[model samples]
Target: MTDPSQPEDTDPDAEDGFYVLHLFVTGASLHSTRAIANLKQICESYIPGKYSLEVIDVYQQKALAEQEQLIALPLLIKRMPLPERRLVGDLSNTEKVLTGLGLSR
Candidate 1:
């Protein structure tokens, strides 16, 4: 009952699909800058093109922040791949952040 011409699906969580992350930052503060750098490093080293990151500055878009129920200055929301997750602060903890985003090895 399988098509020989089609490639086999090898990913275990392929059904879950990729992830979309929304990073909420208050301003161009140190924490926000660090969060962006750290997140970029992690994603590039581990997940690569498996996810997408959308950075939103609350200082510029306070209404969007309020809509997402953001109460912290730097918050990362994993919006896709099922079982949404949130992480607050500068995102310095690589393991914790990766685990939260379901990208940990």
Candidate 2:
């Protein structure tokens, strides 16, 4: 769990929306590595410092996987700013991922 007391880049009380991304991967498979790299690139390029990202390895914490209801590896969960969302797979489709995060028009 993130420390809510620590100051975040964005004002928690501000009206402007922010995003919390949780990525779940399994082991060190090629797909897992690719998803991490690709998602990071997209977030840095599009969302930049506006979002917070947390990567979790289901292989290390199987309980979290079940709790999150993750059906597959390389799952990305958008946890904040209302309308919680998720994307599953290797995250190769940049456009779809962006759309899912409501970052693209």
List ranges where model 2 is wrong by over 4 Å. 1-16
Query: Which candidate comes out best when scored by TM-score?
Result: 1
Query: Model 1: per-residue lDDT, tens digit, 1-105?
Result: 666643343333633477788999968899999999999998788777888999999989978988998777699998886567889999999999877777655
Worst 10 residues of 2 by lDDT: 6-15
**lDDT tens string, model 2, 2-53?**
5686343323432256779899998899999999999999988887778899
| Alpha-carbon lDDT of model 1 | 0.81
Off by over 4 Å in 1: 1-16
Per-prediction TM-score to the true structure, in the order listed = 0.82, 0.81
lDDT of 2: 0.81
Error of 2 at 93 (Å): 0.8
